[model samples]
Target: MASSKKSVFAAFTTMEIVLMAMLATANAVMTTYISPINQALNTLGGPIATSSITGIYMIYGLLAYYIIRKPGTAVITYGIGGVVQAFMGTAYGIASCFVAAACYMVIAELVFAIVRYRKWNLGVLMIAGGAMVPIWFFFAANMFHYTKWGTSILLIALGVRIVSGILLCGLLTQVLGSALIRTQLLRRFAISRGQGA
Candidate 1:
């Protein structure tokens, strides 16, 4: 187990899988309840409820990184969220939902691949956050019929996603992770000795 922990292939146990399922379910419910507003907000922010929650998605990847820290753990988290969101979100029978989600998985996986599955490092975290790049360009642009945002516009959007991901996932989720470690629920993943603040 210890050897596995250091590898990027570390997988979530049954309990952690169930726990992520629960968290995804909860987030989806909240997302659905706010669908109308979320829709409008997404439009205002650009499209597809991105940038804002892009970090939230990164947080999931970071969680998986903490546990598995492997080559595919980050990818799996993206897929898990996609499936869970589909199960819980309105989706409205729109094909765009599936396409956008798949795009997210692909792009996020690329970011993790570039970082070689290290999420604790700031550069890796930034790369993970930057994974939203193609999602906005390819998915939102082509699949959703969005107006062609120029390179400058795209950079700004990417910046929002990266910052959001770093703040929410890298920082906030780190707090949650630290707490869990103190409780010993996550000692296998966390190396620190003190009870996390």
Candidate 2:
């Protein structure tokens, strides 16, 4: 038990913790700015427009995981982001922020776990990102009465969200991670330690 505790503690170094905190704070602030855009999209194109950008909401957590390459990276990042969002306030309410965070964390961790946390390719990251959407989508559908939109529309929204997750969350994470690595800013992270950019 003592060894297990130590191992868990060692999983996150001080630098990792600091980076996660910064990313979480960024996530909260970005959500605040993005919320207005999402609201506008909801008004103009309904669920489809908002769904197309849903991936952006989940990117910070994925980027954290990508950089840290650790078991709980995404979970910790999302959890902190949820807490920060609660304090910062959200259009969807504090509870919804947490729910969305939980959903993203669970799916991302599951996807990474399935790969034994050994893969960091674009395909794997895309799979993780795209997989994170459906659970929250269904939950939000029920909570927001989107079920009344008919099965075809619901499926379309879901599809758009998945693709958005692939491109915006996963692909963009790789892009940003690579960019950071190129700048040598992430030299201390696992990704820069010969883990491949």
Assess candidate 2 and give its TM-score to the true structure: 0.93
Count clashes in each candidate, considering only residues at least 3 apart in sequence or on different chains: 6, 0
In candidate 1, stretches whose alpha carbon ends up further than 4 angstroms from where it belongs are 1-12, 34-37, 40-50, 91-94, 148-155, 188-197
Tell me each candidate's TM-score: 0.66, 0.93
lDDT of 2 by residue, 110-187 (tens): 998787666898998899889999999988988788999999999999999999999999999999998999999998
> Candidate 1, clashing residue pairs?
8-69, 8-70, 8-71, 9-70, 10-68, 55-165
Model 2: clashing residue pairs? none
Candidate 1 lDDT (Cα, whole model)? 0.57
